[model samples]
Target: MSKAPFLLGAAFVAIVTGLSSIFIVDERDQVLVLQFGQVKQEVTEPGLGFKLPFIQDVVSYEDRILGLQTQPLEVTLSDNRRLIVDAFARWRIDNLIDFREAVGAGGVDAAQARLGSVVSAAIREILGSVPLNAVTSDDRTALMNRIRDIAGREAASLGVEVIDLRLTRTDLPDQNLAATFARMRAERQREAADEIARGNEAASRVRAAADRSVVEVTSDAKRQAEVIRGEADAKRNAIYADAFGKDPEFFAFTRSLTAYERALKSGNSSIVMSPDSEFFDYLRDAQGPQQQ
Candidate 1:
């Protein structure tokens, strides 16, 4: 019975040994087999892998690209402008052996931390040499590419390759926001004042032109009325002259009658004159003062 217990324990240990000696590598992972903390085999492809049981072990790292987001960093531009900047990067391990050697036991996490420092230094170096407008303008793309190139060189030592780096956010600091907004508002107000002044000038010109037109029209109408009135007076005087030329006695008789009618229009009218006055000649006889 003691021998039976010993045999069962041996079988269990053998099964455990077989299980430990075998490993399965997924397509998404790159594994390193280590013996006494030294890398023995680098399994880059997906397959069944084998290692010495109880003496060798495997460490797997992600083979695909990884992403990292940096904390907001303040940068002073060449124009003496301070900006808050946040950036992100895409990276992947290019040399598993070098990556493992550099990061040691900390692996991907340690590599990411070191990569972040390199990226930050590059960001400061490139952005510090340019003005604020360069960072905010279309030239921003070219600037970022420069940063990536600088960061990529430094990252090569850590066996990390920077696929891409981009500035995720660029903004004014909280302390400068109000000042910038105030300056923009003042500029807009100045432009609005200029537009209003221009509009007023245009309106004054229109009003002046309209007033001039009104004066010209009034003067023309008054001149035309006077000309018509002068023409009518000339026609009436000409008609009177022709009638007087036709019969001087008849014209005198008619004029005297018109004067008498006006002088005695009202029943209570009184006139102080001599009895043989020319005014009474028309009443005395049908013949006028010419006969007298």
Candidate 2:
């Protein structure tokens, strides 16, 4: 019983020592073996790793890409437009030894802080010199590439590789939004007014053209009617002249009857005249001016 207890205790101590002297290196992590605050070794590949128990320490950093989100920053453009820019970046530890050297015992938090500073500075530098439209235009792709390049170069010193820089939201400030909307509405109203004016002008021209055409058509119709009436009057006068020449006495008698009928049309319509007036000659005798 005594030997059994001693053997079990020895086995437990050995297992504990074995576990303390060894560490696992996962694929997602970069391992650094440090001896008394000094980097002694780095393990980039995944597998078993070892360090002196109670003397050396191990620190791990993410080898794969990590993310950092920056706070919203207000940037002023060349045209004096204000924009609130929110951005994020992808970064990873490219050199474990250098990362330890640069950040000391600060680890990922320190590295992220460094990245944030550099990225923010880069954003301010690039967007500050350009116009608002440039940042929001098709050239946005190129601008983001420039930002990543500049930030990546800056982050390299801290053993971090900046994979990409992403701008999440770029917009005008709250105070400027109302002004921009007002300008847009004003522009639209102006355009509408111009279109209405043009339409009115076109409509007036059409109306004027129609009025002129109506006047021309009415004048032409009146001229044709006058010509036709004159022709008909001439024909009637020629017929009358022909009948008068063929029979002078009969024609005069009939014409005198027609005049008498018109002059004495009704009994209520009276005219005072002499009994031997020439007007009564036709009524008194149709054969001659004197009674037979």
Candidate 3:
């Protein structure tokens, strides 16, 4: 029984020593072994790793792409427009040795702080050179490309690569937006008024043209009717003149008889007859009582 207790104690010690020396590194991680506050080895491959029993320390970092989202920043354009710009960037550690040397295992937070400075500087420099319209228009793509190039170059010294840079949103301050909307509304109203004035002018021109056409048509019709009536009157006068020229005495005699018949048809009339009267002569010739 005394030997059994001694053997169990020895077995427990062996198991503890083995467990303390063995370390596991996952596929998604990079392990750094430190001995006495100095870097001993950097194990990046996924496998079972061994270390000094209780003398070494292990620190692991992610081996995947890192995401950095910055707080919204207020930037001003050359044209004096103020806007809040929200942005994000994708980055990855390209040289683990350089990253470890520079940042000292702070990992994402250290990388983010360094990257944020570069991003902010590049954004300010580019945005200061452009007007507000260019920043908000389709030209924004070109601006973002320029920003990416500059940011990547800046981050290269930190052993990092900027995979992508994006501006998530660009917006005006609330106070400025209300003022801009008011100005836009006023400009639209002025344009509408100008269009209405032009329409009224065109309508007036059409109405005046119609009135002139009516006058011209009526005058032409009246002139044509007058010409036709004048022609008919002239033809009747010509016929009468030609007939009178052929027989003047017969025409005179018929006219005198017509006058006598018209005078006698008045039933209340009384006539004093004279021998030399033309009326008496016409009556005597008709009756065949005297030859004159």
Best by TM-score: 1
Global local distance difference test of model 2: 0.89
Candidate 1 residues 1-292, lDDT tens each? 3699999999999999999999999999999999999999999999999999999999999999999888889999999999999799999999999999999999989998999899999999999999988998965789999999999999999898999999998899999999989998999999999999999999999999999999999999999999999999999999999989899887887888789778888788678999998679878876455532
Q: What is the TM-score of each candidate against the true structure?
A: 0.77, 0.75, 0.66
TM-score, structure 1 vs. true: 0.77
- For every candidate structure, what is the RMSD over all alpha carbons to the true structure, in angstroms? 4.3, 4.2, 7.2
Report every candidate's CA lDDT: 0.92, 0.89, 0.84
Q: In terms of lDDT, which candidate is stronger, 1 or 3? A: 1
What number of clashing residue pairs does each candidate have, in the order they appear?
A: 0, 0, 0
Model 2 C-alpha lDDT per residue in residues 102-186, reported as the tens digit of each score = 9988999999888898998899888988898898885587888888999999988898899988888799999999999999899
Candidate number with the higher TM-score (1 or 3): 1
When sorted by TM-score, best at the front, the candidate numbers are 1, 2, 3
Instruction: Give the CA lDDT, 0 to 100, for residue 12 in model 1.
Output: 100
Indicate the residue-level lDDT of 20 in model 1: 99
